[model samples]
Target: MQNESSGPDDIASILSNPILNTDSYKASHYLQYPPEASAMFSYIESRGGRYDRTLFFGLQMLIKEYLCRPITPAMIEQAKAFFTAHGEPFNEAGWRYIVEHHGGYLPVRIRAVPEGSVVPTHNVLVTVECDDPQVFWLASYLETMLLRVWYPITVATQSWHLRETIRGYLLKSSDDLAQLPFKLHDFGARGVSSAESAAIGGAAHLVSFMGSDTVLGVVAANHYYNETMAAFSVPAAEHSTITSWGRERETDAFRNMIARFGKPGAIVSVVSDSYDLFAALNAWGTELKQAVLDSGGTLVIRPDSGDPQTIVLQTLRALEASFGSVVNGKGRRVLNNVRVIQGDGVNPDSIEATLATMDQAGFATDNIVFGMGGALLQQINRDTQRFAMKCSAIRLGDEWHDVLKDPVTDAGKRSMKGRLTLLKNHHTGEYRTTTLPVAVEGDWEEALVTVFDSGKLLVDMSLAEIRSRAHAHEG
Candidate 1:
């Protein structure tokens, strides 16, 4: 974890970890549209979330790892092992053919809803194309790679919703709009599925937030999006940090935090519910009031247990009574010098409730920030957005065959047919899906932008651009 290496050494060491393109199933080589047939796949649809479009991510990682490089003998050996494990025929010919035909690039044109566009449900997010009929199979091979985008996209959309929610409350309850982005802190990293998930989900949150503790998210934003620093974290204490000081000296623990991190205007958060919540509040109001006021910084008290809403309300009332309150421009009671952050049991619903309750109590929304964990990241699945990539049309022989599945049992499983075109209605600003002949011309706002083609990254989107679009609700 402490390796201080760069460039060749890091890439060499990291690349040593085997790459698994899960969707490149061992049987995919054989299952592709026959050599005699041609096909185009529309990597269509994500059916959930508040945002119309998903934050397109993970493609660069997939392309760099699997497409940019040539297939090695080691890769073929691994493929063989896969075939043996699956009890299927080894696809030496198919893979070799792929290498010979593909050279060192993915021979497909991927047009997608721009990185941060508001893509509507049932509209094509991505369309896959290849001039070579035999290359149609590559579409499914890349499914696992591209479909994985939903995780980050869904998380980004969820965070965006939370941001919007907070923004609304803040607009109504407070005058400060600039601090809205940092309202919801990302505390979900440790609760995610993996280091990669943490990086992706945490970065997604950064698209709508500026507060984060997941260092890997910083690395990911920089590495993938050309960002110098997408997020910042304040020095804060955890349960262990406070508990290590012992319950007998909890007040001292609070003092030590002020002494060390007491920079004027610098924020430091302390978990205050280690023992008796009420006692801690009493000490913070009486014993710690002078330290907090004189520290020239904001003291964020974190209550990590009990009912989140109730605890938040109690904390707010207690702090207002003890530390006193200041009336903001909105004529609301803003906690003086100190704020409470409810980190436990925080989610979109609870955050909304907490803000509403705070508003009703004549407290400004800016009086506190939110820290969310499991519900922020791992609580969602693919179905949360109903995301799926499928073949909307297939060309076989000389005819364009429209492909769709109209399941009798479920209409939601049904798909669109024929060549698909995503169009933006200029007036209503909503997206519309249409089928067009390959050479058809019409008055349409072409929605899908080419992202990757023939092993080249046609577009390298920056995190800043995506964040701007996402925040502006322009894309």
Candidate 2:
């Protein structure tokens, strides 16, 4: 977030000094890779189809952080000492050039499958290019920044998979498919590593779902993707809010929520597992039945413990016995003016299991929603989707070279080669890689677009556009 006026002779640039790896030197970068290579074309892909597709995200933030921001001379001087202390060789010449000309703009072009595209694993998600071979260190220097994208994309893919899972059950269980988008709620902000992680991971979840409690995720979506309002949250009470009122006044806590947030269309969620979930549900249906019914708004009961499938079904049964139920067109029971939200022990697999059980029990998907915390945001890693950014093609002098790594020990680690273009296999509506640089007429449309080239962001994507694009890939 700083800029430099004069060039650094002895000091290293602030941004490029701290490398994630010990041997991440621009001058001696990727020693095993081609040294004469002037241009490095690195691509990101998932090794297999663990999920439907990888969502392209977080690169906008990466570009904003490093390339677009001004690099102050003072920041570079500070990093120089840190670099020496860390024993990681810094590329002063390469960084100094960036600081001088492009205002810390990284001298690289990153073309990729658009963010929110449901790209199949083993298909190319992104490609980074460097024009000058001598200054190719900048390409490797920025690898750390780009690799951070893997987790966010993995999280997005995971969330999308769950979305499709919920979508299928919704179409079968209820006639109103509009409610499918809000079926999965995000509560993973507290479970993540940091604020930025919460934001990035949360934003990934939002690409598929509309309900979230993470404010940082809302902020991340707005700041990075340029959305006016990214996610929605209803008035909800946590354990602290309810427990603070004392155990004897538990009914009063429930009453207070109804009094404050209860309206014709306002939905309020209450966490009911502080003491007894069934007891509280009974009290709401029997003792406080009139209060909830009189509110005229939907009350979403949140069961935070026990097996989510069992707890949700029991809660629905209790609600139907007291508040009553109406049969949907799909022969599933829908509780009147009430719903259940399972926030605890909810994940992609668990959600699918819960939905399947609910369907078997003659219950509609409209009667329930899921809130995922750690599993939705924090339970993923770069390997969740096996995302790897490797140099598949290199340009040296005037001749272009195809680079690849084939290890006998692990065939999955083998990388793709040559000037790659992501093409849609028309029959499957899925993406595949091709060595052809240009799209053949009527054969395939190029999936990779010039998102960021040189010092400018070529494509400006909106979150709404991204969400539509994401859902378009749904089978």
Best by TM-score: 2
Model 2: lDDT to the true structure = 0.80
Best by lDDT: 2
Q: Which runs in model 1 stand beyond 4 Å of their true positions?
A: 1-20, 23-35, 49-66, 438-444, 473-475
lDDT of each: 0.76, 0.80
Residues 1-475, model 2: lDDT tens digits: 4355446533334334333222335434545456666777777777864675677777776666556655555556665656667776655665567678767666788887888787767888888888766566555566667878887888888888888888989888898988877988899989999987898888888889888998999888888888998989999999999999999999999999999999988899999889999889999898788988898999999989998888888898998898998898988899998999899898877898899999999999999989899998888787777777777777776788888999999998999998777887565666778875665557567778888876788887888988998898554
User: If scored against the real structure, what TM-score would every candidate get?
Assistant: 0.91, 0.92
Q: What residue pairs are clashing in model 1?
A: 52-119, 53-119, 117-475, 118-475
Off by over 4 Å in 2: 1-27, 30-36, 101-103, 425-428, 473-475
Q: Residues 292-381, candidate 1, lDDT per residue (tens digit)?
A: 899899999998899877889999999888878888898888888889888899988899998998898899998899988899889999
**Lowest summed lDDT window (length 10), candidate 2:** 15-24
CA lDDT of 32 in candidate 1? Answer: 44
